[model samples]
Target: MKRIGILSDTHGHWDEKLETFFASCDELWHAGDIGNIQTADTIARFKPLRAVYGNIDDFKVRSAYPKVLQFRCEEVDVLMTHIGGYPNRYEREALALIKAQKPKLFICGHSHILKVIYDKKYELLHINPGAAGRSGFHQVRTAVRLTIDGANMKDMEIYELPRS
Candidate 1:
């Protein structure tokens, strides 16, 4: 089993709380808007990082990460992007990608709102881990952790810190 920690919209900020919350995770997934390459490097040094660049990211960040990432973790097919919408309100590009990839877990971060929803139409779990940086309008910084064992995703937890 691999433990995964997920976050998004860091906007160049990194919190010590994340180190404590994600210490046990085997990997870290950043949805996007990472702000800069320095932050990305820091996170990569902490744990294996899988990331996509968000709209706000600059050339350096975009060069370091893909716009969309699709891969398998254990037995689960996962798709990640920075601007993908949730459920029925998916963005056009994301919707097309979802239909093509048919991932079991679809993750995106752009709205700065935390959401967890199951899309029955596509049979996938969608997660938006909110904004983990101080630059956003979000009142609380949030992240998610879960265990992905084989095809099962369980033991989900949320870590929230009041924005300072």
Candidate 2:
């Protein structure tokens, strides 16, 4: 069983609370818009980081991460991207990738809105951890934590803080 922490849209903002919330996680998955390379380094220093670059990221960040990341965690196939829309509303590129990869878990971050939905048609779990930075329009910053054991994802949790 591996504990995972998921977040996105940091926009260069880092909070100490994130450390506390994700302390137990063995790895961290960032959806995108990581803000800067320093922030990404900070997160990587804390734990293993799997990330994709968002539209807002600069050349340096884009160089550090890919636009789409596909990998396996335990027995689960995972797909992650930045602007991937959820379910039937999936973005063109995202949809094509989904059809090709057929991942069990699909993760994205761009809307700055938290969502956890199951796509019955594709038979995958879609997770958007929302915005964890102070720069977005989101009223509350959020992050997600979950346990991926074998092929099962369970013990999901959320961390939220009012934007100030």
Candidate 3:
């Protein structure tokens, strides 16, 4: 199995708590809103990062963030994007992507709040790591880790990391 760390909406700043959260993963998937290349450069020190361009990400950031990433890791097909579509209308967009990609795991981030939902309606699992930035909402601060096997997945358990 692959230990994957998922983070999104960093908004260009990183705190110590997120550092601890991402330490255990083999690879990290950044779901955009990175805001700057410096953030990506910092993360690269820990693990290889796969990223996508967010509305806030710019040219320098895109150089580090890919629009979409697809790869097989630990026996699972993983697809990642910063914002595949919209959260309020996730089902429709997710179904479309699911039908087209047929991936075992699909991850996205754009919402600054953590979310992990399994849509039986479309047979897709979506993960959002919330914001790991200084301007993020929610007082506790959060991030997520996903463990996967072939076509089986579980909800991402949320962890509140301290701000330092």
Scored by lDDT, the top model is 2
lDDT tens per residue, model 1, 20-123: 99999999999999999999999999999999999999999999999999999999999999999989899999999999999999999999999999899999
Question: Can you write out model 2's per-residue Cα lDDT over 1-164, one digit (the tens) per residue?
Answer: 99999999999988789999999999999999999999999999999999999999999999999999999999999999999998999999999999999999999999999999999999999999999999878999999999999999999999999989
* TM-score (C-alpha, index-matched) for candidate 3: 0.84
lDDT of each: 0.95, 0.96, 0.73
lDDT of 2 at 75: 94
Quote each prediction's TM-score: 0.99, 0.99, 0.84
How high is the lDDT of residue 92 in model 2? Answer: 98
Off by over 4 Å in 3: 85-88, 91-95, 136-138, 154-156, 161-164
lDDT of 3 by residue, 119-162 (tens): 56545566777777766555555678866655555445577754
Candidate 2 residues lying further than 4 Å off, grouped into runs, are none
Q: Cα deviation in Å at residue 163, candidate 1?
A: 0.5
lDDT of 3 at 55: 77
lDDT winner between candidates 2 and 3: 2
